[model samples]
Target: METILNVEGMTCGHCKAAVESAAKEVSGVTDAAVNLELGNVIVTHDDALNIGEVKQSIEDQGYDVK
Candidate 1:
């Protein structure tokens, strides 16, 4: 499955890396990519992955996930 989340407060490469790292750490996630220019996070995972957990992971990195 794939999930696209709009994240706020990402303004640089570091923010992109942080968000990607957090998202990748979630169980069942296969890959994660962040587009700072678009404020979007694309997550590829299995059905077992919890969307709420993914959002929380990004939030833990100090960003707002919508």
Candidate 2:
């Protein structure tokens, strides 16, 4: 499964990487990608991906989800 989160507060490569890494930390996450300009992150995971956990993981990195 996959989800696209509208992230806010990402302005550079480091910020983008932080959110991506955080999302990947979720147990079921297989991959996490961020688009700085669009302020979004694409999360790819197994069928049982925990969307709430993934969002919280990204938020813990200091980014907001839309």
Candidate 3:
């Protein structure tokens, strides 16, 4: 499964890394890519991946997901 998350407040390399790390914490996530320029995160994961949880994780990192 693939999903794209809309993240806000990303301003640097560290912000990108933070989003990537949060997304990776989801058990079913196989891979994740973030585009700071696009303010989007593309994730590849198994069907078991709970997008809400993933989003929450990213939000916990101080970013907003829409």
Query: Which candidate ranks first by lDDT, i.e. highest?
Result: 1
Models sorted by lDDT, best on top: 1, 3, 2
Best by TM-score: 1
List residue ranges in candidate 2 displaced over 4 A: none
Candidate 1: tens digits of C-alpha lDDT, residues 1-66: 899999999999999999999999999999999988889999999998889999999999999998
Error of 2 at 32 (Å): 0.6
- Across residues 1-64, which tens digit of lDDT does each residue of candidate 3 receive? 8999989999899998989999999888988899999999998999977799999999999999
Q: lDDT tens digits, residues 4-36, model 2?
A: 999989999999889989998889999998988
The C-alpha RMSD in Å for every predicted model, in order, reads 0.6, 0.7, 0.7
Evaluate model 1: give its lDDT.
0.94
RMSD of 1: 0.6
Give the C-alpha miss distance for residue 53 in model 3, angstroms.
0.5
Q: What 10-residue stretch in candidate 1 is worst by lDDT?
A: 29-38
Model 3, runs deviating above 4 Å: none
Pull out the clashing pairs in model 1: none
